[model samples]
Target: MDDQLAFRADDQPSSTSPPVWRVLAVDDDVDFQRATAFALSELDLLGGRIELLQAFSCREAALLLARERDIALVLLDVVMETEDAGLRLIKALREVIGNSETRVVLLTGEPGRAPAHEVMRDYDINDYWTKSELSAERLLTVLTAAVRGYAQLKTVASARRGLQMIVESSNALFCSKNTRELSSKILSEIAVLLNLQAEGIVCVRAEEGEGGVAKARIISASGRFRPSVDASLDSLDSPEVAAVLRRSLQGQQTLCLSDCTVLFFPRFQAGADYACYVATERVLDDTELELLKVFSASISRGLYNVALFSRLEEMAYQDDLLKIPNRNALIRMLDMTLKDESKAERVLVLIDIDNFSGANTAFGTGYGDFILGLVAKRLCDAFDGNVLIARVRDDLFAILGPQTQVRAADIVALFRRQTRPYELGQVHSLSSVTMNLGDFTGSAGVALQDALLTLKQAKRAGHDQHAVYDSRLLGAHAEAYRMLLALRDAVEAGHISVQLQPQIDLQTRRVTGVEALARWRKADGSMVPPLSFIPLAEATGYILPLGDLLMRLALQAAKELADAGYGDIRVAVNVSAPQLLQHDFIERFVAHLQAAGVRPQQVEVEITESVAMRTFDTVCEKLRALREMGVNVAIDDFGTGFSSLSYLRLLPADRLKIDRSFVLEIGQVSNEQMIAEAVIQIAARVGMQVIAEGVETRQQADWILEHGCREAQGYLFAKAMGCSDLLRWLADWPRDRA
Candidate 1:
């Protein structure tokens, strides 16, 4: 018993609080044991709590090991009871006690006394060190590494089990069809998995309407965080939490509250159709991060399925495109508006773009598409407040504004003004388009379809203009519909003819060229002006094929004149905006010149200022190529549109036609004369000749000639005339006359 008392001290637990490690020291010499324990007590493993269990002999150490369960590390000295006693104790620990988790570090005073390699190979000790080389820091370092390894291994094992449980339970919950039930199960399972004290799940629909009012409702909760029967989850008001939830919903991101060590997972499924917020006050580790990522993906898929189901259920009441309310939505809104006392006064406006089909046909189907997209964007941009804008057809849009007809009109006016000059890429230049607005009083109780028909009538009259719906226009549309049908028939019957307008050179005084303009001749031998049928022609896309016919006629006349000793004379043809943008314009024009046996230089293609500026880069490149092939290019009515002098220099042209407005005001306005002079000087500098148009009076023609304008065309020289009149004028030439 006295000999066994040598190990009795080791069986007693140390007095340290929160025991860090229990180390058993084995030595035959009592003083060596006492000295080692004193040295180790002064050591610190990052200020760790340590307990020193002493044993004076190997037998005593073995006895102590059988009693203590938490001995983390063993510091064994060689030659304790015998020369190999420490080594024997290591074997006993492994075989008898089965304490493989405890780390054994061997100590030796004379390493040469034992076969160091053999002893290490025979025992499962962690490390071996000589007493002369041992220090407190070194011992502490070895112990810390061992203890940390043990802790990490335990944590990894525990986390693996936790993850397996989470995955299994999440799969079960996700299989449930009901969103509320699934949400509840998820919250409770996550809470249990994380060992959370409190947990809840909140689902919210973010406001996309006028005021951005969020519709929030707590769907599920568990544990102490659960709300009572009297407690309303919808009334849980915390602006910060709400903002965080909204951000998570919108962005599909997770928000972590480190203060409470809580995590909120916002699940956005089916592109933000539904949002779910899962909140838990549990400190998350690496396992939780992996679990959260997996759970969030499952939740996203579930939410998507739920949203798809809801959408299918509500398919009859939603817009297929733009994802806004549809006719059903509008009717529902109207019903709600009528029910509400606050919305007693409201205005509904039906807007239709003038000649939208004509614009679409002139540009292309692509331009029509761009206009539709622009209309949607502009409508959204203009009335972001209590307003609903929807497209009912290709060219028609509707707007609903509450109260104040004057306010609604102002909004419509602002929208038209803003969208008038909107650019539609390279195809269409900044279009000066306008919306025809028709407003109905809130008290009128008129059907929406009736108002739409009234708006259509106003659009038929003219666009870039508006008219309030009246019974008179409705009556007139019924009559005008017949005329529109007749006009379409006339266009199809080839009732249009090419009329030549001679352009005389101011310097030469002989008819140098004629512009072939279109005219409509009825079966009764009466002629109609271009303004009467051109719009109808453009709208029906008759202009494309019609323009082709006119080109053939114009080129034939030029060829006949050239064949008849008028080789130096040229014919100017005005190209429409649509024709100029056609990809085949150059090929077709060149083909016509070839068939006519006329030089490319004999045909002067005149393009409007607006058309030239809008298609500046494309037109300039095309014109340069045409001029390279000897086709003459001229800018007609240059000052009529907003063209910059810098852009003029960039244009590849043989002539610039000064607009008639400048010539008409040349004698009246000094600024007009200055502008004309500037244009002439710039044209001359760039090696381009200037032709003044609309010179009706002698004073206007004289002012233009005095300003160094090289060419003039107007009544002052000769009014535009038929091909026979041009031929007579050319035959009796007055070269010196202005």
Candidate 2:
């Protein structure tokens, strides 16, 4: 026979009362079970009564604990069907079942079978007493103390477990950087935190009228309510769930019922609130209710931070004016595209409006912005397939798509249609528009940079021109683009150092000055030659910044040399044509000289013969300005490509350096020596100093000096070295002793 008894004050339901404690009694003796139930019914612990759950054997007690997590105590008999049956049951309860929160007490008809001290300590038995000693009064005393201890332990354990849940839930919720992911994480955490079977729905106030909530929508849901996510709250299958959610939102409070609990929490933004309805099978105790309250606050704050982060992140990755993906996001998109093997047939295209800066000046910035948006929309509409179109920068839009769908001719034709006049505000209208485009066949590494290179070529080819990225155009090895990116990092990390190579007087064999050469040393102790990457730098616009850095270092070295009694030494630095034409380049160079405390005459700017061949007014003016400032300009590789006398006459140059090719062929070929001789004569007629480079042999030096070359540099004197090495070389100069 089984006896189950629940002792209560009255049958009337009251909200103020605590839940009753559940105690399971396991014994085959039906009479003893009833007697024990009668004894436990007479007492109360902490304003809560006890309900004695009946079980015939160990199997029944194990099943009861498995079904009920709230069971407070278990009473087991030692000598039941087996002599140690109750002892084995305690082992299963404490070890196999892992119900450490519930209290276990061992009872024995025979005291000698299991020692009281050993049983209580070893088996996790809380209380042990002989059956004969358990009188009605004694049983009441033992049960009251046991139930009180269980309640305290449960509260502490619940608090610990709840805090752990909150930490885990916060991690899951905040890891998401968008609303969609946030909703999914929030709903999943709610179920885990509540220890429910994932049956819940999150309802947010969609709109509010003067009276109350006009419409509420389900943001997220789980388990049985999962289908209701992102749906109207009114469409819930259970009217009870909907009504409780309404009450929760309207009152801005929490409601607890027999089967579920509704909680209302505030959003970060004012007047915006959300309600969570969780289905539970049993009534929650005070500990669980308080835990819920604390977790709800945590969830609210987590949601607010996530929302704020999402907004900030979007701003970081998106263009502000055009509201499209910026350069950084476009690069990430290209990287992702490269990772996808299926996108092998795709092409990356860069579109640039021809003379856009001119248009921006003529039409004003507002009109320019309107035109950008118009172009973006038209490009999106023209591409039939799914494509990623981004405004990388001002008047520059990039698109990635399959070659089968987007061909180069198709893009040119589409933009050609945009050339038709557009009537703006009936007064101001665009009479015509033209675009330059560059495309690459592969969606692989550095596609944007490749497209950019092609775009530059297009611009050079004139308006409305387009070209495909060809590695042959790069004029470097196949891995040149990768090396370019690495070079940029090297510059920023200060890996580029200036090395000084001595220029000697050819006749005296004495060092005249040093040339500052840019040398790169990587982390793995490998050296990158300037010839390998200088062309890439020039093409990719890195030369401007690189030239500025070298100029500053060269100035500093020149200052140090002048202070070290080598005051007559002049440091010559190679300057690219683009660097000379950059805005404010002269001003910044003057500032660098002032900062280094070096006079303008102590430095020389070296330009290639090819640079003088191209005539830009700004470049010519800047060169003349440098000469006027007492800075010397030298035409490097004078006997090399485009050695035109007209260019030499037009450029404001004070020195001409004979090309290394002529010097290297001095003994090998007669024409090379004659070319070197003619270059020196031209420098004399033009009133410019003459220097010869790559004079490695005694014969080459003798020939250059015989031809009236004033200075020469070669490995015969010293390779490029650091400042310390140069100082040592200066002290050990053979010319000074001679």
Which predicted model would earn the best TM-score? 1
* Candidate 2 clashes between residue pairs 3 or more apart in a chain or in different chains: none
Best by lDDT: 2
- Per-residue CA lDDT of candidate 1, range 1-738, in tens? 112111123466668555376777877767667777787776665347668898888898999998886787888887766878888898898899987667788887544334344454467776677764565645655676556444433444455455445445656754444556666666666556666644445555444554875454555555433552123334555555456665655554455555332233332333343444445554567787667666656665555554544554344344444544455456566556555555536655666655565675578656766776676676778776688776554456666666453243464555444454554431221112121222322322233545655564455555454555565554554444444455546556877556566566565565666667776677898886777655544543445666677787788878877887786777887777667766678898899888988888788888888889876888887788788998788998777677887888888899998877777777678754467787788789988988888878878777777778857777766776666776787787674465
Candidate 2 residue lDDT tens string, 283-333: 988888777767666556556555555555455557666677766577787
TM-score per prediction, in order, is 0.45, 0.42
lDDT of 1: 0.63
What number of backbone clashes does candidate 2 have, counting pairs of residues 3 or more apart or in separate chains?
A: 0
RMSD values, in order shown: 33.6, 28.7
User: What is the TM-score of candidate 1?
Assistant: 0.45
